[model samples]
Target chain A: MPAASAIKVMVVDDQTSMRAMIRRALQDLGFKDIRDKPGAVEALPAVKTDRVHLIISDYNMPDMDGLQFLEAVRADPVIGKTVFIMLTGSADREVVQKAAALGVNNYVVKPFAPAALKEKIERVFGELT
Target chain B: MMRRIPIVQGEHAVVAEPGVIISTLLGSCVAVCLQDPVARVGGMNHFLLGEPTEGLGDRVGQERYGVHAMELLINRMMQQGAARNRLRAHLYGGANIIAGLGAIGSSNAAFARRFMETEGIAVGRCELGGTKARKVEFMPYEGRVRSSVVADAPPPVLNIKPLTPPDDGDVELF
Candidate 1:
C-alpha cells in the first residue's frame, strides 16, 4: 500500500460542495495528489491517462451514474485494478450488493465525518500511515 | 392543527384536510405539487429523473422517474375526490448542483411544465433553477407553497423510510 502523501486519489460527484468536502478530508489525511471531477463522464478521460491510485465516487448522477462508471473503470485494461470507494446518501441494499460484486474496495455513507472517511480508507489501504 | 408530512425521493402523499404540510428536499431532482382548491385536496411527489428509458431495465425500482411519479400523484388526488380539471400545479426543485453537466434541473423543470400543459392543468408558480438545492413545503388544502434555497447540502437522510419487505416469498429490493 502507498503512503498517504504518495497516493494519487480522484474524487467524483455531481455536487461541487461534496467534491470540495471530500478533497478537504483527503488533504487533512495528508493526501497530496488529489483530483476532483464533477461526475463520472468528466473523470473517465483523465482516469485513463492519470495514474490514480484510488477513486471515491458518488452513486447518483446525471448521464453516467456511479455504478456504470465503476463498470467502465473495471473494463479498462489500464485502470481496472484501481481501488474504488462508493459514497452515497442512502444505504440502498441492492446498490450496495451490486457495488460489492463490481469489486468496490469500500463504501462510505454521506454526511460522514472526515475521521470516518479516513477509517474506511485505512481499511482498504491498511492504515493511512 | 398543522401537521407536517415529509415526501422523500420516489414517494408521494395526498392530503384532503387543512393544516397539513408536505415537504421535501431536492438536488438535481424535481418535486411537483398539485391541489384542487374547491375540493380542499392536494398531493406532492419527489422524483429523481425526468423519465424512464427502455434501456433502464424494469420500472419496479425506478419509481423516482418523473412520468410515473406525476401520474401517481394525479391519480391519488383524483381518488381522494379532487377533480382533474380544477387542479393547479406548483413546481419546485430541479437544481444543477454540478457545474459542467447538461442542465438536468432545467430539463426537469421543462418536463414538469410540459406535462402539466399537455394535461390542461394550470401552473400557478414555479421555483426552479440556480445552483443551490431547495427545501420545499406545500399545504395541499390551502394551495400554498414555500421554498427556500439551502446554503449547504443537508444530510442525506430520507424523512420516510422504505417499506419493510414481507417476511415470506421472493424478496424484492427497492
Candidate 2:
C-alpha cells in the first residue's frame, strides 16, 4: 500500500461544484498531491506532460468525454497502464462493462461520500496509508 | 385547445403540427426540444443520463442504459421531416435539487449542451443548473418553451457519518 500523500492524483470533471466536492473528499482521505481539470481537453495534456499516478474522471464532458480520454490514455505507450477510476451519474451495467473493457481500474457513481471515495481508491491501491 | 403530452425519463415525442404541447417534470434530468422551422417538425426528449460518443462500437448501447436519449430525439426529429442541419434546440432541467446526490444535474446539462455543440445544433434558449425542480412545456412547431419552477426549497443536507462500506450485497467492486 502506498502513502495517501505520496500518490499524485488527477481529478477531471466539467462541473466546478463536482470538482470541489471530490477535492474535499480527497483531502479528507489525506491525499495531498491532488490536481483537478475542468474536462478531458485540459486533463489529457496534463497527464501526458506530468506524472499522474491515478486519475479520477467524470464520464460525460465536452470536447472529449471520459471514455474517449481513457482510450487516448490507454493507447499511449507511456501512460497506458496508469490507474484510472471513472465517475458516472448512474450504475448502468453496460457502462460498467465498457469501462472495464477499456482497462479502467475502478468506478464510482455520483452522490458518493468521502468514505465511498476512499473505498474505491483502496480497491485500486490496496488500502492507502 | 392543444394536445398535451407529458413525458417522463427516457421518453421522447415527435410532432409536425401546431396543436400539440409536450411537457415534462425535471430534477437533474434534461429535456432537449429540437425543431426545424423550415420543415415545421420538432420533438423533445427527457433523458436521465449519458453523453454521446461517435464511432464507438455499439456506441448508443453503451451510453446510459443501452440508449442515448439525445440521439433518440434527434432521430425522431429527422424522421418527422426535420433536417439535421436546421435543428434548433431549447434545453431545460439539470437541477441539483438534492444536496447529497452530488452534481448529477450539472453532468446531465453539460452532456446535453456538448451533444448539441458537437452535432452542430444551435441552442436558442435554455434553463439549466439550479437547486429547484421545474415544469417545462414545449410547443414543438413554434419552438416555444414555457418553464416554471414547481419546487425550490433546498433539500435538507445529508448528515453523513463515516462508517464502514455497506455490505448489503448491493455493492459491486469493479
Candidate 3:
C-alpha cells in the first residue's frame, strides 16, 4: 500500500452533523486530505474531477442514493474501482443484502467508531496494493 | 412477564423495577433518555415531527412537535429532583422507516440535537437516525437502555380480514 499521506477520502451524507462526525473520525485517524458533502448528487461531479482514493457514503439520501453513486463511479473509467465503503444506520438483512450485491468495499452500520472505519480503509488500500 | 406499555409520540414515563419502556412503532420518530448519575433515575420519551404543534387532533390534543417531547422528558427529571447540571442523555430511533424522502429522520435528529443544546445537557451516547423500528427499555436504577431495533423491510403488513363480508351466500354448511 502507498503511504497513508497519499490517500484522499470523500465523506458523503445528507446530514451536516453526521458528515461532521465522520470527518472528525477521519481526522482522528490522521487522514489529512478529507472532503465531505451532503449527498451523492453533490459528490458525483467532484469524484469525476478530484484525486479521490476512498469514498465513504451514507446509503440513503434525498437527491441520489449511495448505491446509485457507486454505480456511477463504476461506470466512469476516471473513478472506477475507487475504494467505496457505505455507512447506514440500519443494517437490516435486506439492506445488507442489496449492498453486498452492489459490490461495496465495506458496509458499516451506524454508531460506529474510527477504528472500524480505519480498519476498513486500511483493508481496501491493502487489497489495491 | 413483561408488560407492554404503548408510548405515544411526545410522551415519557419512569418505570419501577421490572417495568420496561415500550413504544409501538417508530418511523421517522426518535426516543431519547436523560439519566442522572448520582440519582440513577432515568426518563425516556418518543418524539414525532420537528417542532411543537399549533394544531390539535380530536383526541390527542396538540404539540408543536419533538420539542414538546424533549421538554416533557426534562420536566420529569426535574420533578424527580435530578439536578439539571448533572444529567446526561442518550438518544435512539429516529428512522426514515417510511419510504421516499430521507428528510424526515434527518429533521427528527436535528431537532433532538438542537433541543439538547438549548437545555444545556450533555449527551453521553446515542443511537439515532436510521430506517428501522426500535423497541427500547430503560433500566432506571442503573441508567442502562437496551434496544431491540429492527431494520430492513418495513414492518410486516398484517393481513387484516374484513370484519363484515358483502353478502352471506348459501353454501353447504360443512
Candidate 4:
C-alpha cells in the first residue's frame, strides 16, 4: 500500500461546504494530493484524466448520486479498480447492500469526525502513518 | 404544569424528574426515546442517519448522526442514574412527506431500529415509515410518548395583527 502522501483522493459532493469539510479531514490525515468536484457529472471526467487513487462521493446529489457514480467508475476499464468510499447521510441496510453489490470499498456517514475517516481509510489500505 | 422543550434536528435532552416534555416535528427524520424505568431516568434524540463512524467528533457538528446521538443520550441517562441493561426505547418519525424523492424516511427508520438492536435495547411503540409528517411529544421521566400526523395539520396562528402601512416616501408594508 502507498503512503498517505502518495495517495491522490477525489471528493465529490454538490455542497461546497461538504466538499471543503471532507478535503480538510483528508488533509489532516496526511493526504496532500486531494481534488474535489461539485457533482458526479463533473467528477467523472476529472477522475478519468486525473487518475485519483481514491474516490469519496456523497450519496445524494442533483445529478448522478453516489451509487450511480460508483457504477460508472466500476464500468470504466481504466479506473475500475480504484478504491471507492461513499459518503452518505443515510446508512440504510438497502443502500449499504446495494453499494456492496456495486463493489464499493467502504462508506462513511455524514457528521463523521476526522478519526473516523482515518479508520475507514485504514480499513481499505491498512494502517496509515 | 409541564415545561416543553422543542428539539430540532441533531438535538437531545434527558430528564429524571417529571413535568418536562421534549417535543419535535419530523419529516424523514427519526427520534429515539430511551428510558430506564427502574432508575426513572430517560432522554430522547433526533437523528438523520445511523452509525457512520464508531465515535463522534468533539464538535457539536457531529450530533446529527444516530450513533453519536444514541451514545450521548445513553451516557446522559446513565449520569442521571439509569442503567444500560434496563433501557427501553420508543421510536417515532421517518415519514416520506414527498413522493419522487428517495425513501429517506424508510432509511432513517431502519437505521434507528438497527442501532437499538445492535445495542441490545428493547424497543416499544415504534411508529415509523409512512407518508405523513408527524409531531411527537415525549415525557422522558414518565416514559410516555404521544404522536400525531401533522402533514395536513394547520399552521399555528400568530397573535400579532397585520402591520399598517406608514405614509412614508420609500417605506412600504404588506
Screening candidate 1 with a backbone cut-off below 3 angstroms (N, C-alpha, C), the clashing residue pairs are none
Question: Taking the tens digit of each residue's C-alpha lDDT, what string does model 3 give over A20-114?
Answer: 66777776666778898877999999888885988999776655778888888888877888888887543234655666666777766553545
Put down candidate 2 lDDT per residue, B13-102, tens digits, no spaces.
Answer: 998899899988878778888889999898888776633332224222223321245645665676677767788989888898877878
**Backbone N/Cα/C clashes per model:** 0, 0, 9, 0
Across B1-174, the per-residue lDDT of candidate 1 in tens digits comes to 799998787788999988999998988788999999999999999876633333135222222245545655775687688877798999887788767656877887776777777667898888887778899999998888999887655326566433222121121221
Candidate 3, B131-159: lDDT as tens digits: 77766766655676677766675544333
Off by over 4 Å in 2: B1-173
User: What RMSD does each model have against the real structure?
Assistant: 15.1, 11.1, 20.1, 18.1
State the weakest 10-residue window (summed lDDT) of model 4 chain A: A88-97
For all predictions in the order shown, the interface RMSD in Å is 13.3, 11.0, 19.5, 20.8
Clashing residue pairs in candidate 4 are none
lDDT of 2 by residue, A1-129 (tens): 889999999999865545666777788788999999988999988999996999999886656878899999999999998899998644344666787889989888654546667888898898999
Give per-residue CA lDDT, model 4, range B44-134, as digits (tens).
8877663334323533233235555675677668768887779999999877776765776788788788777766789999999888878
lDDT of each: 0.75, 0.75, 0.65, 0.76
* Model 3: fraction of native contacts: 0.00
Highest TM-score model number: 2
Superior by lDDT: candidate 2 or candidate 3: 2
Per-candidate TM vs. native? Answer: 0.50, 0.52, 0.46, 0.51
